[model samples]
Target: MPVKYQQETAQITWEAAQALIEAVLKEGAAQKIAFSIAVMDAGGHLRAFGRADEAAFLTAEIACDKAWTACFFGQPTHIWNSLVQESHMAPLASHPRLMAVGGGYPIFYQGRLIGGLGVSGGTYEQDQEAAVKALSFTGFDKL
Candidate 1:
């Protein structure tokens, strides 16, 4: 292999990220809940974020962490719970941005990892539902 080879990368567009945020908010409204939603690029950088007027302010950071966990790990944030159970893996929990909650999911398109979506301000199950609903509504792959 060449010392410095090129590689292709796919990313979530700003338009798509905005649409995902809107869809999550819409889902929250339909469920009579407030939510903070965040979208992160494949590299775990914040791309878009939004919140319902009544959502808890603290949920902003939680939402971003959730998305960061999912995107960077290439798995749902909740998976961290089981992954860290082993003694040898316990230290992984110390990573500040690793959210072991159910609201974050990786975003994929045609088998390509594009980004991640996260929702907060409700029960973990509810947050997960919102994230999944938005991904489905906006034509993103569901995890």
Candidate 2:
């Protein structure tokens, strides 16, 4: 048999990114909080982004960082807080793109990691809520 080291992986479409952004916005509105949102491909590249008029300016970058962090780690950005508590993982706290807060989640489809989603501008818990709601509402798994 031939070596099969490579395999196909799903990529999040531009339209899906946009839809996720819209879904995030909807959830933010429901929560009565403005949010900055970002979506990234599996490679941690930004695919789509948005910031509500009332969202803090800093939220934009935070949202992007959250998405990138989630994609880069293949887990929710919030997990970094607990993960970094380990003595050896503490060094990760210095990485510029590592967002150890909340509002970041890996996007999964059929057990395949496809991309990431992040939301900001509210409390970390609120951000997490919005991220999860938006992911499921958009037919993606928040894993």
What TM-score does each of the candidates earn? 0.95, 0.93
Best by TM-score: 1
TM-score of 2: 0.93
Give the alpha carbon lDDT tens digit for every residue of 28-134 in model 1: 89999999999999888999999999999999999999999989888988888888888998998999899998999999998899998889999999998888888
All candidates' lDDT scores? Answer: 0.91, 0.89
Which ranges of candidate 1 are over 4 A from the true structure? 1-4
| lDDT assessment of candidate 1 | 0.91
Model 1: how far residue 8 lies from native, Å? 1.7
> Model 2, range 99-121, lDDT digits (tens) per residue?
99999999888888888888999
Q: List the residue pairs that clash in candidate 1.
A: none
RMSD of each: 1.3, 1.4
